[model samples]
Target: MGDGRGGGGGNRPAWLQLYDLVGKIGEGTYGLVFLARPKQRKGCIAIKKFKQSKDGDGVSPTAIREIMLLREINHENVVKLVNVHINHADMSLYLAFDYAEHDLYEIIRHHREKLNHPINQYTVKSLLWQLLNGLNYLHSNWIIHRDLKPSNILVMGDGEEHGVVKIADFGLARIYQAPLKPLFENGVVVTIWYRAPELLLGAKHYTSAVDMWAVGCIFAELLTLKPLFQGVEVKATPNPFQLDQLDKIFKVLGHPTPEKWPTLVNLPFWQTDLQHIQGHKYDNAGLHSYVHLPQKSPAYDLLSKMLEYDPRKRISAAQALEHEYFRLDPLPGRNALVTSQPGEKAVNYPARPVDTTTDFEGTASVQQPMSANAIPGGVTAQSMAGPRPGPRQISMVGMQRMPVGSMAAFNIPSQAGMNLNPGGIPMQRGPAGQAHPQQLRRKDPAMGMQNPGYPQQKRRF
Candidate 1:
């Protein structure tokens, strides 16, 4: 395999060489994302190719974690992962995802440049509602998107008049079933600007509330068209520490003493940063500096709760979704949430049909080789490890074969006795090693796929 630096390699991996490179979309410390069209897929999609080294340290495990989490998460508000392609020759891996035209960060940046009115309340509320819905789904599935920022919140169209918001970029996400070990003992997560106080204070056993903190910061930025906490720059003039903006928050929302936030004094990093300050009276006199809203507005209150210093007291994503702030009149009713636009149709991807005679239920099966055209350059077939199977083929009795790509729609029922395939994909089964005949039927295209037109349902505000 060739090292990924500068794209130098003897022979480009089959997958990389197969897709016609259009142009770069975004770049980060990890890798370059490109706007490309897959040979099999109809529309243009964003393909993130992570850099890898011959020794394997450049690409982080976070990338694999994102792929694993996304495959099981079937939510409209979350970005969709089309497929993953690994190039063993170059040690590079590619993640193909649905493409969004714009992100919340660009929208805010553009709004700032115009000096025009920032995002209006209706739009902000709508976006916030979608964000909470996405988070709700993630938390329900025991997944935590540690990195939540404007840059990760993608918008599908133009504005509130037509655009839809969806959460993307799960590079820093993890399945949070149990308490995380100490950051010092393992790894520190979350982006700095949106990091929760609990994380900054080095709290190890935290909950999903940490993500809500980032949501609060993102909401504040959308309203003010500026970062909530622009960290102190080291090279600034009148001494860097002297110009610290920690109090900017306190000034807007009244100072939180040990009485208001009892946990603040106990945080590991609080004394060094906030204890010595004197006469630091918070200035909540005017609301104009924070968001262009009355102090008593419901949105304002919700934002405050989201940004609460105490993680224990923070509002949950599920609770926030039901808040009155998002229930404004003139929107659809709660039960009538629009999953798809009125007339939009679902797109079906081409897939090869699998033989139903094979014991795919309760046992792992070797994945069939992807079509040469489906994969660009050809890929070598890899078998997953699993329990040994007794060598015997049952007579073709009552077996059914479904059309290609038809079974992609239905989700396996929770009560179904399913086994993880060697490849980690789930396969459903019946009693005594007998494959369920019902699984062979074609499923409706709309069953499991997200609607492409409107990425998520508009909140019934």
Candidate 2:
């Protein structure tokens, strides 16, 4: 199964050769995603190849978990797993999917420098509609997209103006077969920026509402073009009123109390040991503070409801779709608005042909040095060793070399110089690693300087 070049590890089954791999589309901890074309089909497809461990364990459990969940779920807004391929020799697994143009993160980055024509309100509504629709489908199926963010949403077919948006990456999604429990012992489930307050408060039993909180944050970011609640420090601290962002939310929406948020005091972090800081309001604020605010319109109201402090009070994804925001003139539609941005055009490319070699042989290529930034915590890795249970950690080297489609499947960041290597492995260091905290602290240029409602936390899968 191994190509003489050490490229193909004979990890892919013979039947999988029916599809031609064009090139690397993305890379992740466990696998490489490639732009592939089925020999019999006309359009392109995304082929995710999970690196197999030398031992019996083929694909990482994290990948298996994602495949298992994605297989059973189908919705227009959700990315579909077209097929799976298993290679017996190396225990590798390949997942095929419909190809997409770009992820929301890429779109945001492309438009970061431009302010006048930023994603219009209509476009935001359409994307939000699709996101909520996908979430609704997942929640209805008793699944939770623990990680929901711009990076995870892939733009397909040509969104309303440019291409359609599809919710991708279900690696962290879990089924709600029983009452909710602490999925992670350390309360480190979601990403920092889009994480919900309840998660930070250590609430063991939660619901789909957690996803709504993230959606709210994303909506605000869409309007403001920056993360709503990126805390100053990595280590959690009780800075109740210091963050001007949250204070602005209270100023516009009013403060919340135990009565307003009944479970606020019951959260794991809200015990008597947790200090109760008095509320504060923003005074003498300038126009710059609220310039990005959506006109006092229905979209604004729905955004407010989604960002509600009380998870119970949050609007359901289905309910949010029915809101008037989506009914506005030039109704939000599927497909992205096209532009002349670099890498935006859909290119017609040929697929990479499969090698006709018969025997599986190991090549002598030297393993590349690991990247300085390892895969983040919670990401699973594919081991060359025996099968390990639960989630495995993907290595940084594996990620950089991973195929494009696989990278999309795993929601890896697309920044050119960012070190996506997992586990802090210091093979290659990039500007992202050298970026100062202050540089990271700058607000998302797309969202601008205006504080929009609650600061959204990152939702990790």
Question: Evaluated with TM-score, which candidate comes out highest?
Answer: 1
* Winning model by lDDT: 1
Q: Alpha carbon lDDT of residue 44, candidate 1?
A: 53
Put down candidate 1 lDDT per residue, 197-255, tens digits, no spaces.
66655564677788998999998998889888765433342222322444555555566
lDDT per residue, candidate 2, 1-461, as tens digits?
A: 22222466354444555655333445655556655456776655666676664343444656666665655544556775666555544445566666666566655654565433466555666677767766765665456788888777776543222355677777677765442345643245555567766665557678778889889888877776776666543455432222333344445445556898998877655553334323343343422244356447676688778877788888876677667776655465554343323465432211212222211222234334222122111111111011111111111122222232243443423332122223222222123213212221212222121121111321111
Per-model CA lDDT versus the true structure: 0.54, 0.53
**lDDT of candidate 1?**
0.54
Stretches of candidate 1 exceeding 4 Å from the true structure: 1-11, 53-59, 158-162, 179-186, 233-245, 271-289, 330-461
lDDT of 2: 0.53
Error of 1 at 192 (Å): 2.3
